[model samples]
Target: MYYNILRGGINLKKENITFLDVLTLFIGCFLMSLSLNMFFNPHSVAPGGITGFAIIVNSMTGIPLWVINLTLNIPLFILAYKILSKKDCVKTILGIIFLTLTLKYTIGLSEIHVTDDVLLASISGSILMGVGLGFIFRINGTTGGTDLLGLILNRFFPSLSVPILMGSADCIVVILSGIVTKEIEIGLYSAISLYIIVKISDIIIEGFNNSKSFTIISDKYKEISSSILEELDRGATILKGEGVYTGNKKNVLLVIVSRRQVVTLKKLVKEIDPNCFIIITSINEALGNGFKSIE
Candidate 1:
């Protein structure tokens, strides 16, 4: 998916965007606005980023959220235009315009809510916003806000992760919301909403088939490899390695499997060679012949 986006970006200078791209952008922004008006804003739960900032401003000054959102994003748009690619800037502008419009028109949507459960509202609202964000990101567009600021800051500080920087910025807003409202639970709920948004956005962008990667070192490498291929119906790759402690050559096995299969694979490996060294880690995405298709 990323490779295709990069390829499309190269040709994006021609400014030829498909109807589907525009449709996706509009849908994403609309959902974001709906979630804000109906769930987050009504409940005073700030989910962080530009949206959170807008929520805070609205709460304090009695201004409409759409107005605050647009007012704050204008400078960010200028910054994006200067720092990001033209294609990116165009998409961001489209997102901002549609998002603000949706927020303006959907002002009364929150009044019709049936549930007052803050937990339910926070989680559901976060999911909606996250999916909206995922769509924008999938199309190589960003909703102009702290996300764009994080990108620009990354240029000056190459070693810092953008998500961390953005997360920290968001926490500050959440904390301020607590201080201003004098309700500690609101801040705690906001933090929960923020976490849900990040997680859901990752799942949308990375795909839903969560998997784990395992690296194994053992004397019975061949048997373990065969068991994984034949018994578990999973592929295994043998990597050549040199053990520095004993100066011995060894074969390391690498395998990928679903989260549920981790226990079964671990048992199989232990049965084959109890002394085997194993390392397991979760992977966000895996695309190829055995897993998801690239397309």
Candidate 2:
């Protein structure tokens, strides 16, 4: 009985600490820390969300950024715990802890003057911060700020999408920039920073080597499948699908290929069977060979 209980407990723990989850948290925290210390702090640019609040509070009170970051994140974390899953809350906590520690230890060492140019700082900081946030989100965790607001919106209004909610939250922050800093330049830089960060984060999390999922209803199934494997060096899975209207049996060829190879694959299918019904969609992250590695 004791041995069984111990084994069960070990398995339970193992289930919690997945390799992908850990990697996501580590990368997310690292990017966020780097962006904060290197770009945002040096220029005193607020990029929005909890970090923005932290920066504003830090500037006004002279408290360390890390302390402000921790205090600001706690209520957001609690909101996340209540609205989101327990696992998400735990992962976010771990990410926040790592971010705080990195900021506390490394902020002093990072270059305080990357560039005197405000535009450069705003752009670079936004990109780095967005990429970091994206990585965290990819693993179904958030850094606790506007993310909590996003979650609350998602929970209460399931129809409203994340992007819409995020936009709404960030817009409020941008408007609040006027109150934080008197100069209009600060607000402009803040807006620029937010834009850069969001776009970059989307790209990073989606990855450069994205894949397209193609569903082709072609008479030349064998030819198309063989060509995909031989020419594209990609794999195809065939599903037995039936036409709803005609009640006719159809051979549906499903294949995933990189963005670079998508045009080629489409052309090949067209050449093989002009009448082929093809549907192509984007797969944000594909793991394994020719894709994102979970590890």
Candidate achieving the largest TM-score: 1
Give model 2 RMSD, 1 decimal.
5.4
Candidate 2 residue-wise lDDT, 40-75, digit = tens: 766667888878767667667778778988887777
Once superposed on the true structure, which residue ranges of model 1 sit more than 4 Å away at CA? 1-17, 151-165, 267-271
> Judged by lDDT against the true structure, how good is candidate 2?
0.78
* Best-performing candidate as measured by lDDT: 1
Off by over 4 Å in 2: 1-15, 18-27, 79-81, 109-111, 152-166, 215-222, 233-253, 263-267, 270-282, 287-295
